[model samples]
Target: MQWITIFKKEILEDWRNYKWIWVPLVFIVICIMDPISTYYLPQILESVGGMPEGTVLEPPEVVPSQAIMMSLTELSMLGVLVIVAISMSVIAGERKSGVAELILVKPVSYFTYISAKWAEKLLLVFTSYLIGMLASWYYVDLLFGQITAGQFFSLFFFYLIWLIFVISLTIFYNTIVKVPGLVLTLTVVTIMAMSAINQIFSYRMPWFPNSISGHITKMLMENSVPNALWGAVSITIILSVGLLIASNFILKTKEMAD
Candidate 1:
């Protein structure tokens, strides 16, 4: 019940801060741009006419699935930065501003406090992403080709787990680090390190969370998903939950010290 109360408060704060507006707007622009640009690329190149007079430029046929995937890939970079920027401050900023102290001194458990924050952020990010994906899908279907509902849902489910991992990692650092800048740096470094490690050891460890992107691509381009993907999904879920628990534990420890 307290979580619901805090969740509502968080949502109101986000709206007042313009996060609800700008975050989703950014995602929509990022996603839809991919499909629209890809669709008009050939015509735009022809209009330029800078190529050799004798050369005819032939753009490869772009498929709907590939176009959608490309948009998702772009999100993993720019959109993820947006996520990090917004989430880095969820705990650290609150703690620095005395907001956390004000709230925690009340009847709220630290776990309840963290849960409410986590749930609110999760809803915001996931809703923004879903809206973006749907917008991109509309263009991809109109310009490229029709994408099956099954394919759309599959991609959605896989990417959701990946996002869970990302948000959890950022929130974990936010709880432990007092400075938002340091939390951002640490979160980015940890993500990059994990991604690099997954790249290096993908053969031996297909269950890494970073491997989810590859699995998504495989499912799209190859029309099949590896059985080992379930292992990756399970591990990702476990790690996400572990990180949230760790965040709550660390926050409690820090509170007791203070």
Candidate 2:
């Protein structure tokens, strides 16, 4: 109940402070950009002498499921960037402004405060992904045809896993770095490192959340049930809990320099 109250307060604070604007804008842009690019790309290429003589450039045949997955991947990456930016500021901003001390003085424990913030951010990310998926559906329907519920849900679920992984990375960075800029830089570097490592070693490692999501998306698009779905789920669940535990531990031991 106390955590719920804290979570509610955090949501209200986000609304009041205009933190809700970025998610919608970022996701909407992703939704609109995907179909527009997929629809007019060949035409744009043709206009630019992209089709050479004797080389017929046929329009790329995009399956509805593939298009949805593609759009979801693009939007989800953007969501990762946005979430990292938001999470970088989550703790460091409060600490810089002396708000951390004020909040700590309240009845809230450090664990509650950290957990509430993460929960709020995760909810916001999920909402953003949902809006982006809906927008993609509308655009795809207008351009192509209606997609199946299975297709939509599968793609959405894949992206949701990606989002959770990104959020976990962000929270991990937030706990380690006290400056927003440093946290953001570290988060990006961490993401890149993970991607590189995953490329080098294509296993279902717990550290490679983004890659796991991509594999899941590929599985859905190819209409193949991933053999490692259970493994990925287990990784996600374990990593999420691990991140929450680490964040709480750091918050509990952190000293207020103010």
lDDT of 2 by residue, 140-209 (tens): 8777666766767776775577677677777777777678898889888888887788777766464456
Clashing pairs in 2: none
Q: lDDT by residue for model 1 over 1-258, one digit each (tens)?
A: 898999999999999999999999999998888788878887788898787677766656988888898888888888887888888998899888787777777888888888788889999999899999999988889988998888898898888898888889999998998789988999889988998999899999999998987888888877777776778999999999999999988998896324
Q: For candidate 2, what is the TM-score?
A: 0.87
- Cα lDDT of all candidates, in order? 0.87, 0.74
The C-alpha local distance difference test score for the whole of candidate 2 amounts to 0.74
lDDT (Cα, 0-100) at 136 in candidate 2: 84
Best by TM-score: 1
Off by over 4 Å in 2: 45-57, 203-208, 222-224
Q: What's the distance in Å from true for residue 109, model 1?
A: 0.7
